[model samples]
Target: MKNKFIYLIYVILSNLPDFYMIRVWFRNITKLRAKVLKLLPNMEISNGVKIYRGVKISRNSNLILSKGVVIKEFCILGGTIAVGEDTQILSYTKIDGSGKVTIGRDTHIGRENDIFSHYHNISDKNILVNKSKECFQEIHIGNNVMLYSRVAVMGGVNIHDNSAIAYGSIVTKNCEQNFIYAGVPAKKIGERI
Candidate 1:
């Protein structure tokens, strides 16, 4: 089928180190090299992983992704994004963090999932121009959790192991083990099968 053919071609293209060498050559010639190098602050990136075009990584962060992790199209991230082996962050999953985000082993975050560690206090009218410094918190997603499509996790939340967060759920608290939670401010629906 045409889809299979396209995938095969993609696999072949991804394997070609010469293509990456050419990319490096082209990148070095451009004015964007400084801007590109400014993105990675502290990170150890392994080879053979696909970093798509237009991906903006942050400058001050610890990002260590193991092999075969495909960070797909237009996915912008910043923070401690330590993806375990074979984890896939699909398209447009904004793993933005001012604090810390530790995604445990073997997790898959679906498209457009905003896992933010913390946010600002814009409501404080007393402070002029919101002059208060960045407020950060920890977001710990346990092992083997599948965050379905469009899931948004707020700051300071801990998700337990073997848990699955359903689509469009806004998680604002701790999710227990082996549970399925889906809703605004996501709650426990039932036990997973």
Candidate 2:
């Protein structure tokens, strides 16, 4: 009940335009917000994990942040998201893990990157208002991966280890390990050196 109350407050705050400024202020004062989040049942934060202000998280969501993870300011990351050790998620990144999003160790998610683990239901013609079942798929981002700015990773995509996704790319499928991908649909451009 307590966790749900906090989640409701966060949901309401997220809708506010000045929420980002409020979060940045919270980051400057202390780690109180982070400490409060530690009380959530599904959240696990190891030592040295830094969550900057203006980051809206869900209490009911399973969010595991390993050691040395730094989530920058103004990031809306929530749901069943597991960020590996030492991974850095830059500002303005939005991760929706309503299904599951697993980001591996030493990964760098650049600014404005959007990651989604679920797609809205709009398939059924009979029920236009209600729609069909939601499409929920997991997103697996492997170790040492680099997702550049403005990257949009769709649901059910697997970004393999040591891969680098170029800026402004849209990933729709599985990316091969140790390669560089770019452009719409994110084709393999070259091998990672």
Candidate 3:
């Protein structure tokens, strides 16, 4: 019983700030500026780093950004989206979760990427507000994985340790440990470095 109480308190405490932050950000979003006002830059955010207002970041103190990691307009990040040394994230990417989102060193991500951990209940609109109707899953990306622009990654998708995904790809399937993939539903075309 005590453990349950502690767990409940911890969960609420962790999400309270992030939840409110996203709310305030969306409420104050302008036509040009993205809302990252809820995020206090602690570690190095680097030059040319752009964050959208609806980002769901964990503690800023625990997050670190290397040089040249650029997030474009309407890009959502707030979980532990730790860019490794000298990695670059191009425009219009979305990352949301409290689960681990570890980007490898020197990985490059292209534009219009949707990365998330939570799934909304689209079947019924009002049921999504019940808090008990939501389901979440974690996604893990490998070191040196290069995902091109306009990639749509659904839940339960994992790219292995060193793979490259081509542009305009819909990743409904996972690629092998070291391969290159492309197309609407991406598939392993060949092995790559």
Best by TM-score: 2
Q: What is model 2's C-alpha RMSD?
A: 4.0
- Give the number of colliding residue pairs in candidate 3: 3
Tens-digit lDDT track of model 3 for 47-103 = 434343333333432455655444444455665556665566665677665454666
The Cα error of candidate 1 at residue 65, in Å, is 0.7
The Cα error of candidate 1 at residue 121, in Å, is 3.0
CA lDDT of 151 in candidate 3? 81
Name the lDDT value of residue 190 in candidate 1: 89
Question: Over the full model, what C-alpha lDDT does candidate 3 score relative to the true structure?
Answer: 0.59
lDDT scores for all predictions? 0.72, 0.84, 0.59
RMSD of 3: 10.6
Lowest summed lDDT over 10 consecutive residues: which window, candidate 1?
29-38
Q: Which pairs clash (backbone N, Cα, C closer than 3 Å) in model 3? A: 35-53, 56-78, 57-78
* TM-scores, one per candidate: 0.74, 0.83, 0.60
Output the better candidate (1/3) by lDDT.
1
Q: Return the candidate ranking by lDDT, descending.
A: 2, 1, 3
Tens-digit lDDT track of model 1 for 103-164: 77777889988999877776777886568556788999888899998999988999988899
Provide the lowest-lDDT 10-residue window in model 3.
30-39
